[model samples]
Target: MKSSIVAITLMALFTKSFDPQPELINKGNSWNKNPVIAHRGAWKKNNLPENSIASLKEAIRLGCYGSEFDVHMTLDSVLVINHDADFYGLHIAQVTYKELLTKKHPNGENIPTLEEYLKEGIKQKKMKLILEIKPSKNDPERDQKLTDRAVAMVKKLKAKEWVDYISFSYDVLKRILVLDPKANVAYLNGDASLEKLKADGFYGADYHYSVYQKGEWFAKAKELNLTINAWTVNSAEDMKWLLKNKVEFITTNEPELAFETIRAVQSGN
Candidate 1:
Protein backbone atom coordinates (compact mmCIF):
# COMPACT_ATOMS: atom_id res chain seq x y z
CA MET A 1 0.00 0.00 0.00
CA LYS A 2 2.84 2.44 0.77
CA SER A 3 4.58 1.68 -2.53
CA SER A 4 1.35 2.13 -4.47
CA ILE A 5 0.73 5.47 -2.82
CA VAL A 6 4.25 6.68 -3.70
CA ALA A 7 3.80 5.62 -7.33
CA ILE A 8 0.50 7.45 -7.56
CA THR A 9 2.04 10.63 -6.15
CA LEU A 10 4.92 10.45 -8.62
CA MET A 11 2.55 9.96 -11.54
CA ALA A 12 0.34 12.81 -10.40
CA LEU A 13 3.32 15.14 -10.09
CA PHE A 14 4.80 14.26 -13.49
CA THR A 15 1.54 14.12 -15.40
CA LYS A 16 0.39 17.60 -14.44
CA SER A 17 -1.74 18.91 -17.28
CA PHE A 18 -3.07 22.30 -18.33
CA ASP A 19 -5.27 23.49 -21.14
CA PRO A 20 -3.44 23.09 -24.45
CA GLN A 21 -2.86 26.69 -25.53
CA PRO A 22 -0.19 28.75 -27.30
CA GLU A 23 2.07 28.54 -24.23
CA LEU A 24 4.02 31.71 -25.10
CA ILE A 25 4.94 34.32 -22.52
CA ASN A 26 4.51 37.87 -23.72
CA LYS A 27 7.33 40.34 -23.00
CA GLY A 28 7.24 41.60 -19.43
CA ASN A 29 3.68 40.35 -19.62
CA SER A 30 4.10 37.17 -17.63
CA TRP A 31 5.79 36.68 -14.28
CA ASN A 32 8.45 34.23 -15.53
CA LYS A 33 8.98 35.43 -19.13
CA ASN A 34 10.24 32.06 -20.43
CA PRO A 35 12.06 32.83 -23.67
CA VAL A 36 12.14 29.63 -25.66
CA ILE A 37 9.47 29.52 -28.35
CA ALA A 38 8.82 26.43 -30.45
CA HIS A 39 9.33 27.07 -34.14
CA ARG A 40 6.48 26.07 -36.47
CA GLY A 41 4.95 24.42 -33.43
CA ALA A 42 7.34 21.82 -31.92
CA TRP A 43 7.49 19.65 -35.04
CA LYS A 44 7.76 15.89 -34.88
CA LYS A 45 11.01 14.00 -35.30
CA ASN A 46 12.20 12.43 -38.61
CA ASN A 47 10.57 14.95 -40.95
CA LEU A 48 6.99 14.33 -39.90
CA PRO A 49 5.80 17.86 -40.94
CA GLU A 50 5.28 21.33 -39.43
CA ASN A 51 2.66 24.02 -38.73
CA SER A 52 -0.04 21.47 -37.98
CA ILE A 53 -2.40 21.08 -35.04
CA ALA A 54 -0.72 17.89 -33.83
CA SER A 55 2.64 19.61 -33.68
CA LEU A 56 1.20 22.62 -31.85
CA LYS A 57 -0.57 20.49 -29.24
CA GLU A 58 2.66 18.57 -28.75
CA ALA A 59 4.49 21.84 -28.19
CA ILE A 60 2.06 22.79 -25.44
CA ARG A 61 2.39 19.33 -23.89
CA LEU A 62 6.16 19.77 -23.84
CA GLY A 63 5.73 22.96 -21.77
CA CYS A 64 7.30 25.38 -24.20
CA TYR A 65 6.83 29.01 -23.16
CA GLY A 66 5.51 29.91 -26.58
CA SER A 67 5.28 28.89 -30.27
CA GLU A 68 5.52 30.69 -33.57
CA PHE A 69 3.41 30.01 -36.69
CA ASP A 70 2.35 31.67 -39.92
CA VAL A 71 -1.17 32.70 -40.91
CA HIS A 72 -2.64 33.48 -44.34
CA MET A 73 -6.07 33.95 -45.87
CA THR A 74 -7.55 31.41 -48.27
CA LEU A 75 -9.39 32.14 -51.45
CA ASP A 76 -12.55 31.97 -49.39
CA SER A 77 -10.97 34.45 -46.95
CA VAL A 78 -10.58 31.96 -44.14
CA LEU A 79 -7.49 32.11 -41.92
CA VAL A 80 -5.39 28.95 -41.58
CA ILE A 81 -1.87 28.10 -40.45
CA ASN A 82 0.64 27.14 -43.17
CA HIS A 83 4.33 27.86 -43.63
CA ASP A 84 4.71 27.88 -47.40
CA ALA A 85 2.98 28.58 -50.66
CA ASP A 86 1.19 25.70 -52.36
CA PHE A 87 2.07 24.19 -55.74
CA TYR A 88 0.08 27.04 -57.28
CA GLY A 89 2.82 29.35 -55.89
CA LEU A 90 0.59 31.23 -53.47
CA HIS A 91 0.01 30.49 -49.81
CA ILE A 92 -3.35 29.90 -48.10
CA ALA A 93 -4.60 32.95 -49.95
CA GLN A 94 -4.87 30.89 -53.11
CA VAL A 95 -6.80 27.94 -51.66
CA THR A 96 -10.19 27.74 -50.09
CA TYR A 97 -10.21 27.19 -46.30
CA LYS A 98 -12.42 24.16 -46.88
CA GLU A 99 -9.87 22.69 -49.26
CA LEU A 100 -7.15 23.18 -46.70
CA LEU A 101 -9.25 21.54 -43.97
CA THR A 102 -10.09 18.60 -46.24
CA LYS A 103 -6.43 18.07 -47.17
CA LYS A 104 -3.81 16.32 -45.09
CA HIS A 105 -0.06 16.73 -44.98
CA PRO A 106 2.25 13.83 -45.78
CA ASN A 107 2.44 13.32 -42.03
CA GLY A 108 -1.38 13.27 -41.85
CA GLU A 109 -2.09 16.50 -39.89
CA ASN A 110 -5.33 18.22 -40.68
CA ILE A 111 -4.60 21.81 -41.60
CA PRO A 112 -6.07 23.80 -38.70
CA THR A 113 -7.90 27.08 -38.96
CA LEU A 114 -6.52 30.11 -37.13
CA GLU A 115 -9.59 30.15 -34.92
CA GLU A 116 -8.87 26.61 -33.83
CA TYR A 117 -5.30 27.53 -33.02
CA LEU A 118 -6.35 30.67 -31.16
CA LYS A 119 -9.02 28.83 -29.23
CA GLU A 120 -6.51 26.32 -27.96
CA GLY A 121 -4.03 29.06 -27.15
CA ILE A 122 -6.53 31.22 -25.30
CA LYS A 123 -7.63 28.27 -23.18
CA GLN A 124 -4.29 27.98 -21.43
CA LYS A 125 -3.63 31.74 -21.14
CA LYS A 126 0.06 30.95 -20.86
CA MET A 127 0.43 29.98 -24.50
CA LYS A 128 1.29 33.10 -26.51
CA LEU A 129 1.48 33.35 -30.29
CA ILE A 130 4.19 34.83 -32.49
CA LEU A 131 2.11 35.11 -35.63
CA GLU A 132 4.12 35.52 -38.83
CA ILE A 133 2.32 37.10 -41.77
CA LYS A 134 3.55 35.17 -44.78
CA PRO A 135 2.94 37.14 -47.96
CA SER A 136 3.43 35.34 -51.25
CA LYS A 137 5.58 36.61 -54.06
CA ASN A 138 2.66 36.17 -56.43
CA ASP A 139 0.16 38.23 -54.48
CA PRO A 140 1.12 41.88 -54.25
CA GLU A 141 -1.87 43.00 -52.17
CA ARG A 142 -1.94 39.93 -49.99
CA ASP A 143 0.22 41.41 -47.23
CA GLN A 144 -2.20 44.17 -46.38
CA LYS A 145 -5.18 41.86 -46.65
CA LEU A 146 -3.57 39.24 -44.46
CA THR A 147 -2.70 41.85 -41.86
CA ASP A 148 -6.22 43.26 -41.81
CA ARG A 149 -7.77 39.83 -41.56
CA ALA A 150 -5.39 38.72 -38.83
CA VAL A 151 -5.97 41.83 -36.78
CA ALA A 152 -9.72 41.38 -37.18
CA MET A 153 -9.59 37.75 -36.07
CA VAL A 154 -7.42 38.61 -33.11
CA LYS A 155 -9.86 41.29 -32.05
CA LYS A 156 -12.84 39.01 -32.65
CA LEU A 157 -11.36 36.34 -30.43
CA LYS A 158 -10.39 39.10 -27.96
CA ALA A 159 -6.97 37.46 -27.91
CA LYS A 160 -4.91 40.62 -28.29
CA GLU A 161 -3.87 40.00 -24.71
CA TRP A 162 -1.91 36.89 -25.70
CA VAL A 163 -0.61 37.52 -29.21
CA ASP A 164 2.22 39.42 -30.92
CA TYR A 165 2.75 40.22 -34.61
CA ILE A 166 6.07 39.70 -36.35
CA SER A 167 7.16 40.47 -39.89
CA PHE A 168 10.24 41.22 -41.99
CA SER A 169 8.54 43.85 -44.07
CA TYR A 170 8.38 47.34 -42.62
CA ASP A 171 5.24 48.13 -44.62
CA VAL A 172 3.34 45.20 -43.17
CA LEU A 173 4.36 46.14 -39.68
CA LYS A 174 3.12 49.66 -40.29
CA ARG A 175 -0.16 48.29 -41.51
CA ILE A 176 -0.58 46.29 -38.33
CA LEU A 177 0.11 49.40 -36.27
CA VAL A 178 -2.52 51.23 -38.24
CA LEU A 179 -5.03 48.40 -37.85
CA ASP A 180 -4.52 48.25 -34.11
CA PRO A 181 -2.13 50.67 -32.53
CA LYS A 182 -2.08 48.68 -29.33
CA ALA A 183 -0.89 45.46 -30.96
CA ASN A 184 2.71 44.47 -30.28
CA VAL A 185 4.83 44.38 -33.45
CA ALA A 186 8.19 42.66 -33.65
CA TYR A 187 10.64 43.63 -36.36
CA LEU A 188 12.00 40.26 -37.56
CA ASN A 189 15.13 41.62 -39.32
CA GLY A 190 16.60 44.16 -36.95
CA ASP A 191 19.77 45.20 -38.75
CA ALA A 192 18.96 48.89 -38.81
CA SER A 193 19.52 51.57 -36.20
CA LEU A 194 17.16 51.54 -33.22
CA GLU A 195 16.57 55.24 -33.77
CA LYS A 196 15.58 54.62 -37.38
CA LEU A 197 13.11 51.93 -36.39
CA LYS A 198 11.82 53.83 -33.41
CA ALA A 199 11.30 56.99 -35.40
CA ASP A 200 9.18 54.86 -37.66
CA GLY A 201 7.22 53.64 -34.61
CA PHE A 202 8.02 50.02 -33.67
CA TYR A 203 7.26 48.22 -30.42
CA GLY A 204 10.25 45.89 -30.41
CA ALA A 205 12.59 43.95 -32.68
CA ASP A 206 14.13 40.46 -33.11
CA TYR A 207 17.35 39.90 -34.96
CA HIS A 208 19.74 37.17 -35.96
CA TYR A 209 22.44 36.85 -33.29
CA SER A 210 25.06 37.37 -35.97
CA VAL A 211 23.48 40.68 -36.93
CA TYR A 212 23.80 41.95 -33.39
CA GLN A 213 27.18 43.48 -34.42
CA LYS A 214 27.89 44.42 -30.76
CA GLY A 215 27.63 48.05 -31.69
CA GLU A 216 25.72 51.24 -30.86
CA TRP A 217 22.45 49.68 -32.11
CA PHE A 218 22.24 47.24 -29.21
CA ALA A 219 22.81 50.02 -26.73
CA LYS A 220 20.33 52.17 -28.58
CA ALA A 221 17.64 49.47 -28.46
CA LYS A 222 18.22 49.14 -24.76
CA GLU A 223 18.07 52.89 -24.25
CA LEU A 224 14.76 53.14 -26.06
CA ASN A 225 13.24 50.65 -23.62
CA LEU A 226 12.36 48.34 -26.50
CA THR A 227 11.76 44.63 -26.07
CA ILE A 228 14.09 42.38 -28.08
CA ASN A 229 13.40 38.70 -28.77
CA ALA A 230 16.01 36.81 -30.76
CA TRP A 231 15.23 33.75 -32.88
CA THR A 232 16.24 30.11 -33.45
CA VAL A 233 18.64 30.26 -30.51
CA ASN A 234 19.72 26.63 -29.86
CA SER A 235 23.07 26.79 -28.09
CA ALA A 236 23.59 27.01 -24.32
CA GLU A 237 26.36 29.51 -24.77
CA ASP A 238 24.00 31.71 -26.79
CA MET A 239 21.22 31.45 -24.22
CA LYS A 240 23.70 32.46 -21.53
CA TRP A 241 24.75 35.39 -23.65
CA LEU A 242 21.14 36.47 -24.26
CA LEU A 243 20.20 36.14 -20.61
CA LYS A 244 23.33 37.99 -19.51
CA ASN A 245 22.70 40.77 -21.99
CA LYS A 246 18.99 40.83 -21.04
CA VAL A 247 17.37 40.11 -24.37
CA GLU A 248 13.66 39.97 -23.56
CA PHE A 249 12.73 36.83 -25.48
CA ILE A 250 13.97 33.92 -27.66
CA THR A 251 12.28 31.39 -29.93
CA THR A 252 14.01 28.05 -30.22
CA ASN A 253 13.38 24.67 -31.77
CA GLU A 254 14.47 23.08 -28.49
CA PRO A 255 12.52 24.88 -25.78
CA GLU A 256 13.15 22.29 -23.10
CA LEU A 257 16.86 22.31 -23.79
CA ALA A 258 17.03 26.10 -23.69
CA PHE A 259 14.87 26.45 -20.61
CA GLU A 260 16.91 23.94 -18.63
CA THR A 261 20.14 25.53 -19.79
CA ILE A 262 19.05 29.07 -18.85
CA ARG A 263 17.74 28.11 -15.42
CA ALA A 264 20.90 26.18 -14.57
CA VAL A 265 23.16 28.98 -15.72
CA GLN A 266 21.13 31.64 -13.93
CA SER A 267 21.15 29.63 -10.76
CA GLY A 268 24.89 29.22 -10.90
CA ASN A 269 25.35 32.94 -11.39
Candidate 2:
Protein backbone atom coordinates (compact mmCIF):
# COMPACT_ATOMS: atom_id res chain seq x y z
CA MET A 1 0.00 0.00 0.00
CA LYS A 2 2.82 2.41 0.88
CA SER A 3 4.58 1.67 -2.41
CA SER A 4 1.39 2.43 -4.39
CA ILE A 5 0.96 5.68 -2.48
CA VAL A 6 4.56 6.69 -3.20
CA ALA A 7 4.08 6.02 -6.95
CA ILE A 8 0.92 8.10 -7.00
CA THR A 9 2.69 10.93 -5.18
CA LEU A 10 5.51 10.88 -7.69
CA MET A 11 3.09 10.94 -10.61
CA ALA A 12 1.23 13.91 -9.14
CA LEU A 13 4.47 15.80 -8.66
CA PHE A 14 5.58 15.08 -12.19
CA THR A 15 2.32 16.31 -13.62
CA LYS A 16 2.42 19.50 -11.57
CA SER A 17 5.93 20.28 -12.62
CA PHE A 18 5.11 19.69 -16.29
CA ASP A 19 1.97 21.80 -16.46
CA PRO A 20 3.42 25.33 -16.19
CA GLN A 21 1.35 28.30 -15.18
CA PRO A 22 0.51 30.66 -18.01
CA GLU A 23 2.06 33.66 -16.24
CA LEU A 24 5.41 31.93 -15.86
CA ILE A 25 5.92 31.24 -19.54
CA ASN A 26 8.64 33.43 -21.06
CA LYS A 27 9.48 34.57 -17.56
CA GLY A 28 12.79 36.32 -18.14
CA ASN A 29 12.33 37.47 -21.71
CA SER A 30 11.92 41.17 -22.37
CA TRP A 31 9.70 41.74 -25.42
CA ASN A 32 9.60 44.81 -27.67
CA LYS A 33 8.28 48.17 -26.38
CA ASN A 34 4.87 48.17 -28.07
CA PRO A 35 2.20 45.51 -28.62
CA VAL A 36 2.32 45.52 -32.43
CA ILE A 37 2.77 42.09 -34.01
CA ALA A 38 3.51 42.31 -37.73
CA HIS A 39 1.18 39.94 -39.54
CA ARG A 40 3.16 37.80 -42.03
CA GLY A 41 5.94 40.23 -41.27
CA ALA A 42 5.78 43.87 -42.41
CA TRP A 43 5.08 42.86 -46.00
CA LYS A 44 2.06 44.93 -46.98
CA LYS A 45 3.55 48.40 -47.19
CA ASN A 46 6.67 47.39 -49.16
CA ASN A 47 4.77 44.78 -51.21
CA LEU A 48 7.36 42.23 -50.19
CA PRO A 49 6.25 38.64 -50.57
CA GLU A 50 4.69 37.36 -47.41
CA ASN A 51 6.72 34.81 -45.39
CA SER A 52 9.91 35.75 -47.24
CA ILE A 53 13.04 36.35 -45.21
CA ALA A 54 13.06 39.88 -46.61
CA SER A 55 9.67 40.56 -45.07
CA LEU A 56 10.71 38.99 -41.75
CA LYS A 57 13.71 41.31 -41.69
CA GLU A 58 11.47 44.29 -42.39
CA ALA A 59 9.34 43.43 -39.34
CA ILE A 60 12.47 43.28 -37.23
CA ARG A 61 13.61 46.61 -38.66
CA LEU A 62 10.24 48.11 -37.82
CA GLY A 63 10.77 46.94 -34.22
CA CYS A 64 7.46 45.13 -33.99
CA TYR A 65 7.05 42.95 -30.89
CA GLY A 66 6.49 39.81 -32.95
CA SER A 67 6.33 38.82 -36.62
CA GLU A 68 3.74 36.14 -37.40
CA PHE A 69 4.44 33.50 -40.08
CA ASP A 70 2.91 30.17 -41.11
CA VAL A 71 4.60 26.76 -41.30
CA HIS A 72 3.71 23.61 -43.26
CA MET A 73 5.56 20.36 -43.86
CA THR A 74 6.40 19.26 -47.40
CA LEU A 75 5.85 15.77 -48.77
CA ASP A 76 9.46 14.78 -48.23
CA SER A 77 9.21 15.87 -44.57
CA VAL A 78 10.97 19.18 -44.99
CA LEU A 79 9.29 22.00 -43.08
CA VAL A 80 8.86 25.23 -45.05
CA ILE A 81 7.37 28.63 -44.30
CA ASN A 82 4.37 29.89 -46.30
CA HIS A 83 0.94 31.23 -45.37
CA ASP A 84 -1.31 29.09 -47.58
CA ALA A 85 -1.42 25.35 -48.20
CA ASP A 86 -0.72 26.04 -51.89
CA PHE A 87 2.35 27.88 -53.13
CA TYR A 88 1.73 29.33 -56.61
CA GLY A 89 -1.02 26.73 -57.20
CA LEU A 90 0.95 23.63 -56.12
CA HIS A 91 -0.23 22.19 -52.82
CA ILE A 92 2.74 22.47 -50.45
CA ALA A 93 2.19 19.14 -48.70
CA GLN A 94 1.82 17.27 -52.00
CA VAL A 95 5.29 18.21 -53.30
CA THR A 96 8.83 17.87 -52.07
CA TYR A 97 10.65 20.98 -50.85
CA LYS A 98 12.84 20.98 -53.96
CA GLU A 99 9.85 21.12 -56.34
CA LEU A 100 8.35 23.91 -54.24
CA LEU A 101 11.62 25.83 -54.42
CA THR A 102 11.37 25.89 -58.23
CA LYS A 103 9.13 28.86 -57.69
CA LYS A 104 10.42 31.90 -55.85
CA HIS A 105 8.86 34.76 -53.97
CA PRO A 106 8.24 37.87 -56.05
CA ASN A 107 11.41 39.20 -54.41
CA GLY A 108 13.39 36.25 -55.88
CA GLU A 109 13.72 34.48 -52.55
CA ASN A 110 12.83 30.81 -52.37
CA ILE A 111 10.27 29.60 -49.87
CA PRO A 112 12.30 29.56 -46.67
CA THR A 113 12.68 26.36 -44.75
CA LEU A 114 11.78 26.62 -41.08
CA GLU A 115 15.46 26.34 -40.18
CA GLU A 116 16.41 29.21 -42.46
CA TYR A 117 13.67 31.40 -41.06
CA LEU A 118 14.70 30.66 -37.48
CA LYS A 119 18.37 31.34 -38.13
CA GLU A 120 17.56 34.76 -39.59
CA GLY A 121 15.08 35.53 -36.80
CA ILE A 122 17.57 34.66 -34.04
CA LYS A 123 20.06 37.27 -35.30
CA GLN A 124 18.31 39.87 -33.14
CA LYS A 125 16.71 39.44 -29.70
CA LYS A 126 14.03 42.12 -29.50
CA MET A 127 11.33 40.61 -31.72
CA LYS A 128 9.63 37.22 -31.51
CA LEU A 129 8.82 34.70 -34.24
CA ILE A 130 5.11 34.00 -33.94
CA LEU A 131 4.92 30.62 -35.64
CA GLU A 132 1.48 29.52 -36.80
CA ILE A 133 1.50 25.79 -37.55
CA LYS A 134 -1.03 25.40 -40.36
CA PRO A 135 -3.18 22.28 -40.14
CA SER A 136 -3.35 19.79 -42.98
CA LYS A 137 -6.63 19.97 -44.92
CA ASN A 138 -8.17 16.69 -43.77
CA ASP A 139 -5.31 14.62 -42.50
CA PRO A 140 -5.07 14.39 -38.75
CA GLU A 141 -1.98 12.23 -39.10
CA ARG A 142 -0.26 14.84 -41.22
CA ASP A 143 -1.31 17.51 -38.79
CA GLN A 144 0.31 15.57 -35.95
CA LYS A 145 3.47 15.07 -38.00
CA LEU A 146 3.62 18.75 -38.86
CA THR A 147 3.23 19.68 -35.20
CA ASP A 148 5.90 17.19 -34.16
CA ARG A 149 8.36 18.26 -36.83
CA ALA A 150 7.88 21.98 -36.15
CA VAL A 151 8.40 21.55 -32.41
CA ALA A 152 11.41 19.30 -32.92
CA MET A 153 13.00 21.82 -35.28
CA VAL A 154 12.40 24.69 -32.89
CA LYS A 155 14.03 22.68 -30.12
CA LYS A 156 16.96 21.66 -32.31
CA LEU A 157 17.63 25.26 -33.33
CA LYS A 158 17.31 26.45 -29.72
CA ALA A 159 14.87 29.09 -31.04
CA LYS A 160 12.32 28.47 -28.31
CA GLU A 161 13.43 31.68 -26.62
CA TRP A 162 12.66 33.71 -29.73
CA VAL A 163 9.56 31.80 -30.77
CA ASP A 164 5.95 31.71 -29.59
CA TYR A 165 3.14 29.76 -31.24
CA ILE A 166 -0.33 30.61 -32.53
CA SER A 167 -2.62 28.22 -34.36
CA PHE A 168 -6.19 27.85 -35.59
CA SER A 169 -5.80 24.14 -34.93
CA TYR A 170 -6.50 23.40 -31.28
CA ASP A 171 -4.86 20.01 -31.61
CA VAL A 172 -1.65 21.59 -32.87
CA LEU A 173 -1.52 23.92 -29.90
CA LYS A 174 -2.28 21.07 -27.54
CA ARG A 175 0.49 19.00 -29.10
CA ILE A 176 2.86 21.91 -28.60
CA LEU A 177 2.07 21.93 -24.90
CA VAL A 178 2.58 18.18 -24.71
CA LEU A 179 6.04 18.65 -26.25
CA ASP A 180 6.95 21.74 -24.26
CA PRO A 181 4.54 22.70 -21.54
CA LYS A 182 6.13 26.06 -20.91
CA ALA A 183 5.77 27.25 -24.47
CA ASN A 184 3.79 30.47 -24.91
CA VAL A 185 0.82 29.37 -27.02
CA ALA A 186 -2.35 31.15 -28.13
CA TYR A 187 -5.43 29.93 -30.02
CA LEU A 188 -6.44 31.67 -33.27
CA ASN A 189 -9.72 29.92 -34.13
CA GLY A 190 -11.60 32.55 -32.08
CA ASP A 191 -14.20 30.06 -30.85
CA ALA A 192 -12.71 28.71 -27.62
CA SER A 193 -13.57 30.62 -24.51
CA LEU A 194 -10.84 32.24 -22.45
CA GLU A 195 -11.79 29.94 -19.59
CA LYS A 196 -11.41 26.86 -21.78
CA LEU A 197 -8.07 28.18 -23.01
CA LYS A 198 -6.79 28.85 -19.53
CA ALA A 199 -7.97 25.47 -18.29
CA ASP A 200 -6.32 23.75 -21.21
CA GLY A 201 -2.94 25.35 -20.37
CA PHE A 202 -2.92 28.08 -23.04
CA TYR A 203 -1.06 31.29 -22.35
CA GLY A 204 -3.33 33.63 -24.29
CA ALA A 205 -6.50 34.20 -26.29
CA ASP A 206 -5.73 35.28 -29.90
CA TYR A 207 -9.16 35.80 -31.40
CA HIS A 208 -10.32 37.93 -34.28
CA TYR A 209 -11.26 41.49 -33.26
CA SER A 210 -14.86 40.74 -34.18
CA VAL A 211 -15.01 37.81 -31.77
CA TYR A 212 -14.22 40.05 -28.84
CA GLN A 213 -16.74 42.67 -29.92
CA LYS A 214 -19.62 40.20 -29.87
CA GLY A 215 -19.20 39.18 -26.25
CA GLU A 216 -17.56 40.10 -22.96
CA TRP A 217 -14.41 38.17 -23.85
CA PHE A 218 -12.15 41.17 -23.47
CA ALA A 219 -13.19 41.80 -19.88
CA LYS A 220 -13.11 38.07 -19.10
CA ALA A 221 -9.62 37.80 -20.53
CA LYS A 222 -8.37 40.65 -18.37
CA GLU A 223 -9.95 39.15 -15.27
CA LEU A 224 -8.41 35.77 -15.96
CA ASN A 225 -4.97 37.34 -16.52
CA LEU A 226 -4.84 35.87 -20.01
CA THR A 227 -2.85 37.61 -22.74
CA ILE A 228 -5.23 39.08 -25.34
CA ASN A 229 -4.15 39.33 -28.98
CA ALA A 230 -6.33 40.13 -32.00
CA TRP A 231 -5.20 39.40 -35.54
CA THR A 232 -5.03 41.18 -38.92
CA VAL A 233 -6.47 44.28 -37.34
CA ASN A 234 -5.65 47.05 -39.85
CA SER A 235 -8.22 49.75 -39.30
CA ALA A 236 -7.19 52.64 -37.09
CA GLU A 237 -10.62 52.70 -35.49
CA ASP A 238 -10.41 49.02 -34.54
CA MET A 239 -6.88 49.57 -33.33
CA LYS A 240 -8.08 52.38 -31.10
CA TRP A 241 -10.88 50.21 -29.68
CA LEU A 242 -8.52 47.33 -28.84
CA LEU A 243 -5.86 49.70 -27.54
CA LYS A 244 -8.38 51.55 -25.37
CA ASN A 245 -9.42 48.21 -23.92
CA LYS A 246 -5.73 47.54 -23.07
CA VAL A 247 -5.12 44.41 -25.14
CA GLU A 248 -1.65 42.94 -24.84
CA PHE A 249 -0.98 42.41 -28.55
CA ILE A 250 -2.43 43.42 -31.90
CA THR A 251 -1.36 41.44 -34.98
CA THR A 252 -1.76 43.72 -37.99
CA ASN A 253 -0.60 44.24 -41.54
CA GLU A 254 -0.39 47.96 -40.84
CA PRO A 255 2.18 47.88 -38.06
CA GLU A 256 3.35 51.45 -38.74
CA LEU A 257 -0.19 52.68 -38.32
CA ALA A 258 -0.46 50.52 -35.22
CA PHE A 259 2.54 52.27 -33.80
CA GLU A 260 0.98 55.64 -34.58
CA THR A 261 -2.31 54.61 -32.98
CA ILE A 262 -0.49 53.30 -29.93
CA ARG A 263 1.29 56.62 -29.53
CA ALA A 264 -1.91 58.59 -29.97
CA VAL A 265 -3.78 56.41 -27.49
CA GLN A 266 -0.98 56.63 -24.96
CA SER A 267 -1.08 60.42 -25.19
CA GLY A 268 -4.89 60.40 -24.96
CA ASN A 269 -5.07 62.25 -28.26
| Candidate 2 local Cα displacement, residue 116, angstroms | 0.3
Best by lDDT: 2
Instruction: Write candidate 1's Cα lDDT for 211-249 as tens digits.
Output: 664665545666786667778787888877776665667
lDDT tens digits, residues 1-269, model 2?
Answer: 99988867765553343222346347456667567899999999999999899999999999898999999999999999999989998799899998997898888999999999999999898888999999976898999998999999999999999899999999999999999998989999988988999999898888888888887876787678788889889999999998777678899999999988866655456
Q: Could you say which candidate leads in TM-score? A: 2
Off by over 4 Å in 2: 1-25
What local distance difference test score does each model get? 0.71, 0.86
RMSD in angstroms between candidate 1 and the native structure over all alpha carbons:
7.2
Query: How accurate locally is residue 144 in candidate 2, as Cα lDDT from 0 to 100?
Result: 91
How good is model 1 by TM-score?
Answer: 0.80
